[model samples]
Target: METKKCTSRQSHFAKKRYILYDVNPLEGFNLRRDVYVRIATFLKRLNAEDKQYQWILVLPPWGPLYHWQSNHIGSQIQLKWGMFFDIESLRKYIPVMEMHEFISDYPVNNGKTTIDIIYQLRNDKNMYETGIFKEKNMIVSCSNGPVSYKIIHDQQYTGFFWGYSNISSYDLQCLIFHGTILNLKNNFNPNLYRSIMFDHMEIPLHYTYGSTEYWEARRSMRYNSILYNIAYNFTSKYINLMEHMDLICDLKNNQGKNLSQKPPQTPVTHGFDLTVNGIAFIVNFLDHFTETYLVIIDAHTKWPKVLNLKKIMEAYGLLEKFKCLLARYDSPIHVVTDGGPQLSSASSLSIEASSSCV
Candidate 1:
């Protein structure tokens, strides 16, 4: 049999061919020769159509080598190679795409389901000027659920094991402050957004136990400090300096107990007791701000008759008084009714200047 010379056209399309030798002839009979022949035939068809393709041939552990070439004369080619007995060993060469067709059906936007992109951005260490619109918009457009464990585990480990655990609660409190600053900086400074994210991060931690317990515990321990620092630095650089002490005070007072318990009780002027609705309103106000002011206009008399301040001072002195009482252990002063109206100017000045003294 004469070996035909290779042509330039054949060489142009068949750039590379990979061949594998098997040690076991029996296995080789099943996989190497048969699979390689099929692949070669497929490549030949593609080449005939002027399409370029790569071919990989797998050889059994041991084999009588079979040759295939367009120019080769007789088909009786055979040569001894090596041996292969382990079926598991064959696994490495198998095409992984055949394992599951569902993987191919995954949505195009499924990459967001993994943590890869988020962590990549985070690891870049460049401070991003991200707004709520961008973050929320990305989340809405994403086809996947929250980030997967594979994506966040590395950052979690790094944040936990790497001395970040040692960060103080006060610093974490600072971060909360900065988050406010950032919110204002973004021009859509909604406290609700931060509140929701914090709640989302916390509720799960509260229930997690055992192995997950450690993760939650570590997260809880570091969450405030890390978030505070991030928020503070980001806000300070990009937004206005926020008055976050009031917010912090509110969170601390409401965590497990009543605001009144934390602060001194003040006497209601005009000797009038508050209705349940009024009390509820006051509590709700405290939940958002440390102070509130109330001007009790007598509905029957059709005139503003009484002024009450919370602890902190603002136009709404009632709410401010409430905040101040929470912050400091001041004696609650009761106002006694005097029909004489001897010092009306003095009373107005005192109410107006309450915040100034603080």
Candidate 2:
């Protein structure tokens, strides 16, 4: 009974640790989205372990991505994650909160929140040069190369934390990491830190590609309804425009000459009863085993003509039926076929004698 009381007490004291992550500054929006799946999978594994502390994933904010170059949408810097993703959908797979929510929940110092630790991940150079890859995770000094985070005078390291000035980190460790995301589990020290951020988090690949966890994480990343509505509106407008226009216009230059180009006119030159301007022909054999029928349709008027054939249909019989159709109406300018054997075996002379087979 005393041991059970101790275990219950420990369970009651379990803390909630937040995992924050960011991709490289050079990475585009789509790649960053993939990184989310990696981190979510890692968090799911961490929680499945039933550790003493509950793990929560802090969603990184969207920002001035190079691919988001649309000038019409105004500045895209420091956009909230909720602007593009459904927060509730994401929570169904893993516990996730936006940057603002994290800030609100975190204790601030002098109007700023200092993350407990930040890991600047770098790819192992030897792996690329030697053409041999192996799992590696080591704490080392920041390389002389262009590092994104800088140590300020206050001993606090600062960088473009999604353009948030109030976020800083005191314990910044440079890690040479090359492996799947599960390998990063070694860095978690729940007793020492509550919030940990990983810069260049995209360096690590998925823990288990195409696994059940991966698919669940992928499905959880639902786009916001606003984006869906925008896409629906744009698609509907474009389809409606295509009904009357055939050419694509430069959206930037709405008044350009390309937008003024006329749509191609239809080739029909005669009224419904005057001439057969176009023809489409097919053969029906499904209903009867002893008889074959040739079907010819006027492309313009949709008028159909069915001619019955004897036990067998030959090229000569097909030509004679076509000639009869021409004799009833003006010779069609174009003739089409389903490429049935009767049509395929017909001599070019016989078909051309009626009309051009197109």
Candidate 3:
């Protein structure tokens, strides 16, 4: 649990190259300390023999960062050195496994693998405060040092197939490969394919209300076709798709039942004014006022859209007018009010009036 920091100067004979390994502590089998010790011993032997290679084993947050740091001591040890790298353990972080899957499936090869951790970036306010990360993917260099690179064409197709946004997919893929080479140059041994695919199978499909329309339309087109059957075959295994299909069935059943219900509510009158805060309060003594008048306008209608008060006053006026008129006249009166300056100043008075009444 102790925090440890290790600083090493650039070797005179050793190029500033490293290989980075992204080790997930929460993953399958945890490597024992003894195993790492043996690896370190082997790496020391390699360094002593002048094999200009360095290997850094990234440990999960749960793993011992200090143990690795303490094991490799002194400045004489050059060429090759083995160290434990545990970002997750240090930060108590959970890497975005799903995004890594999509990137892993991305068909690209630039000698480095880039995992689009955009989903993780979304949860970080500082990383995406402007919403740019939501619309674009972030590419972190998985490599140890800086490197230039390009993605393989097939990987780009994979990104498109996975429905990654264009800008995000391309940039993220490039960043992954570039990061990999950079990490290698920094003397860290990062497993590009393994790290990229860490949480692939468990990655969830992007779901949202906007996607509902697309899914519904797709389901409708496939309902009676061979394509439908094919889709069913593929989607039946996924719980989300199955649940969506059940929802569609329920919706269809509800629609059928609704066809036999009472007719929909319809407003009989067009426009009137209600002035709890308007001139209507001052003009309440107008004997012409009838309870059945449906439309009620307010004075604040001229205000900006964001400041427009709720039409509660108008609604209350209409209801009270209807009750009083029905009791007194035993009939309905279509209430009409002057299209006052405030109401007329705004657009779509007819729509607003109708909506308020209902």
Candidate 4:
């Protein structure tokens, strides 16, 4: 745990990744001591290994804070909510790798920026600088995306509850801020890093997962003002269209109608026929930027499972997923499809399942 020894041991042999993980914020929700103990034990394993690539968890500065009076203390319930690493053990990592160490080394006047180690190193090279912090390229947020919940959490404006809860992404921003604060002993320009962390609180829109339209400029001024309004509109319209059996039964005094009181008397058909289909969408991966996701949906229960595919609806890949579904769930007598080239009846999966495609 000596700072100098840890730093000396930090030399990279291959491309090293600093996987900053968000600690599970809700560890003690059930008021169990065993959960907290397990979380601490689990986190301790991060520094237990030495590898070319590694994961480092940045925990928030968690400590006790009292409201009204010091005597009237907050409960343990308030303590477990923040997602940062446990504050107590965090100091050991100060010399290990600090947040300020990852601060974008770009010039001060340009604007706030995330750590782009290679670009800034090249920028230094432009100035005729050499051997300037020579090390492997460092990429922040290796485990997750740059768009974090804390980055979009708005804190300045006040409401009735008015920041009392701090239930928003406050912990995430604090986690990043502490990353810089912990490494103050070696920060090039602490003030610049502070400003960079400030950007997380200013914007309040979640980053679009699949699209890279705005990653170039972290946030657009126009979208920051009212994009949430559009998001609110879309979120409000999603409702359960299925008939509420409980509500109907309550109104009818249980006279009838558990499920569509009018049953199909003629035949036992589609209910026994469970069909699966998928739509491809873009998703970001750990190593690659994005890949096609084949999201399979059960027509009856509306349950969904996703499979990552290399190409758009590749037949062999589709067959693999179809076989997986058949093994997991009841075998449909016949699988219906729009006869797309990928999910066609001629595919080996239909033959395997003895399923005739429509």
As a whole number from 0 to 100, the lDDT of residue 203 in candidate 3 is 17
**TM-scores of the candidates in the order shown:** 0.15, 0.62, 0.16, 0.20
**Model 2, span 1-358: residue lDDT tens:** 3343233223334488889998877789779888998888888888989567789999888878877779797888878888988687688778999899999987666688878789889989989899999999999877645578888887778888888999988678889999999888899777667788998898998876777667667756756656654643554445442232211111111111121111133222211111111122222332266767665543222345566666446767666765654444333233223222212221332333344332
Clashes of each: 47, 0, 40, 6
lDDT of 3 by residue, 156-264 (tens): 2123222223322222322222111112222222222212211111111222222433222222111122332343344434433222111010011111222111112
Ordered from best to worst lDDT, the candidate numbers read 2, 4, 3, 1
Regions more than 4 Å wrong, model 1: 1-224, 241-358
RMSD of 4: 19.6
TM-score preference between candidates 2 and 4, better one: 2
TM-score of 3: 0.16
In model 2, which regions exceed 4 Å deviation? 1-14, 237-358
- Give the whole-model CA lDDT for all candidates, comma-separated: 0.24, 0.65, 0.25, 0.27
Best by TM-score: 2
Pairs that collide, model 2:
none
Candidate 1 structure quality by residue, lDDT tens digits, 50-83:
3233322332122123423334554322221211
